[model samples]
Target: MWRDSFRLQIFCLLMAVLAIVVLVHNFFQLEHMDDDTISGSNWITENNVQHSLSQTTKTTRKPYCSYKQQTLSKREQAEQESLLAAILWPKPPDGKIAFVESTDPAHSDFVIVKPVRFFKVGDELEVLVRMKDFQGKPKQYGGDYLQARIHSPLLKAGATGRIVDCHNGLYKVFFTLLWPGEVKVSVSLVHPSEAIQVLLRLREERPDRVYFKSSFKSGKYSETTECNVCLPGDLPVCNFTDLYTGEPWFCYKPRKLSCASRISHAKGGYQKGLLTQEESLFFQSDVNIKRPILSSGPDSVIVKSKAFT
Candidate 1:
């Protein structure tokens, strides 16, 4: 009886050893397939797969998270490889600006306007301008100088909007309503993706690029040049006049003369004259700017202008 009992005890020990070997084998197999399995499978290692082995290592693997890291790393590697390839590639087309991502409206994938419209006086208008490539996707980087403006011819009201660069092919425009009327918001790319400041300076310095004039086609037609003439600090713009006619022009009622220098100033010192001429002209026009209908929603009051770039 004693000999039989001893033999049984030896058999039981061998079985226990076999079970441990199987568990160890399974653990190593899981580790080997971790990279591939984690990505496609939502396998939680700690609670499920690793539950049996947790007591051995006292640590659990974040398989899915590790898989995500691997994916992002691979993407970054691919981007780097593409960049290297571009550098080694032959010269591109002549007209293309080097390293510049085009902001042409034709390439725009989509644009989002926040809140769609302003409801009342002093309401803020926000626009999100997304620049896309010919492939209809947001550009990877940003170096474009964008500008936005609000105009309402019927209300004779207008305001210059602010542009915020998000550095990811997205721009934000902010505007405040001075008069409640049907308004049209216009966004344009002032400069391409490269040498933005230099290009802007060139555009501003040359009258042919961005200058506006007031002229009449009657007998002995007269013409006048207008600029946003303002001094630094909060100085009042009192001594302003029409460049050609020498007639005194008051500041736009809403005030277009910026006390501070604009971020995108032209080549030289601020062009001297009525900087707010466009907005003021809209105000002076006979068009009666009025608030939009209430029931149709404020969005009915604001309209997006056609592509201007």
Candidate 2:
């Protein structure tokens, strides 16, 4: 009779433990449920808060500007603005040049000013370049970025040449003779003036041509959202700005995941179709971009000591 009573008590103890575990499990689920509901409702509340702050921007602008450590004065602003038109990046007055009107490196050529039989170290070599268009016509304006270099592959030596733009689509490249060997000179057109205009327009108007994205994860769930130095729209974001550097990095808020769940971030890709039909003609890989100009005379000059010179 005592054994039967002992067995019954053991069974009752087991049932009580199982009931407690089930109750605790349900409580945990309820807590997580509360988090989900709070997350949704708080997001809506934050959106309203953001809207109010934007509306009061004009009134708060003065204090905002004062909060900065340094502010530029009117004279300082004028001084910097005065330097906007640099001689280095001259823009020709004639606008709306078709692709055929752009500079063609293939038709363009450079020739040694005066070919010498032998060049000695410390001697200078001067080359003249004439720019031409696709239709084989001379250009009347200058704004092309040309890169010039002199190198001796056998000696494993190289030196950059100085270029002077003559504003009438004429360029002069000068190289100082440095090594005693066969020195080859090369001049390449880095960008046409037409492409420069398109690039400048993108820099100011479409600054967000290249975009970035970040991944947010929570337990088994994950999400991806666009990110950048500055994002468009009034969407909520996770302010993961660095405390020490004070560099601000913001990612658009994920729909379901929390801000704490962000794991990795990187540049996604460039925006497509940035250029118009006419602008697209300026950037052809096979045609003008980084094409080397043909040499009208000898591309390489023989340099030596007094004996071989």
Candidate 3:
């Protein structure tokens, strides 16, 4: 009787050990199956997020400026010639002389000539002009002559050419200090007959500083009464005070002027490009919410099953 009882006790102990082993193995296999399912779901979600972001980053067709030819009639040409003369040579009080050239390469006719009054030394001056074809349409010439000759003793002959690659119908001639005292600078325009004088001015210099106010509609446009200071053989530079924030900015080159303004405005979490609502949400989603299993050890299955169950 005692031997039988001992055998029964040993068999029961062995059965208990086998049952525990099988239960632990089954728990681990179930955990592995859940992990695989979760991993596949996470991969799908991540791939979707990346795909959405990429799609939003792509650029679609949009409206941009393009060049087009414009035509003008002969009667309109005469009226435009008259207007150009009046603007270029305004009157005695303005103190400037403007000469207009006909656009007809076949004919070199002086379309209009007028007298200007203002004159000063060491002053910054700007000559605004434009060129148009015989039909009075604004025309662009490959290379044009814009010359300024000072009659005073302090004057050194100076002229510059700006390439008219675009048909904007506007050109400017900028110069400074031909001579310090009372002086006169005669401005001339030469291009195939299509060129015309638009404006001439002896503008007073402002104080050393100026402020620029910018506004953004579809794009940006700025207004300021500032002059750029550039060293000889060095790149042009300008200092401008922001009208909106009253902050100061330095522009090392002309191309950077727009970029500087954009950067300044984009400081407070302002983004310029396209991003969809869903894409943005996905970017900000919390990855840990899915309860990712980062690592598993030999004892983790047994420990987790016992603790959670």
| Local accuracy of candidate 2 as per-residue lDDT tens digits, 1-309 | 999999999999999999999999999987775555424212222212111111111111122112234455798658657776443377767767888989999999999888988889889999999999999999988889899999988778999999998989899999999888899999999898778878887876665688877665676455678866556666676665555544445667887777766666667789999989889878888888999998987999988875561
Off by over 4 Å in 3: 1-120, 140-145, 153-167, 189-309
Candidate rank order under TM-score = 2, 1, 3
Model 1 scores a C-alpha lDDT of 0.44
Rank candidates by lDDT, best first. 2, 1, 3
Model 1: number of backbone collisions: 4
Q: What stretches of model 2 exceed 4 Å from their correct place? A: 1-88, 217-221, 239-249, 256-262, 306-309
**TM-score, predicted candidate 1 vs. hidden true structure:** 0.33
Residue 107, candidate 2: Cα error in Å is 1.2
Question: Better model by lDDT, 1 or 3?
Answer: 1
- Comparing 2 with 3 on TM-score, the higher-scoring candidate is 2
Clashing residue pairs, backbone N/CA/C < 3 A, model 2: none
Highest-scoring model, TM-score: 2
Q: Give the Cα error of residue 242 in candidate 3, in Å.
A: 55
Q: Write the residue-wise lDDT of candidate 3 on 111-196 in tens digits.
A: 21122243344444544445443355543432334343334433343433232222344445444434333433343443222111
Let me know the TM-score candidate 2 reaches against the reference structure.
0.69
lDDT of 3 at 137: 53
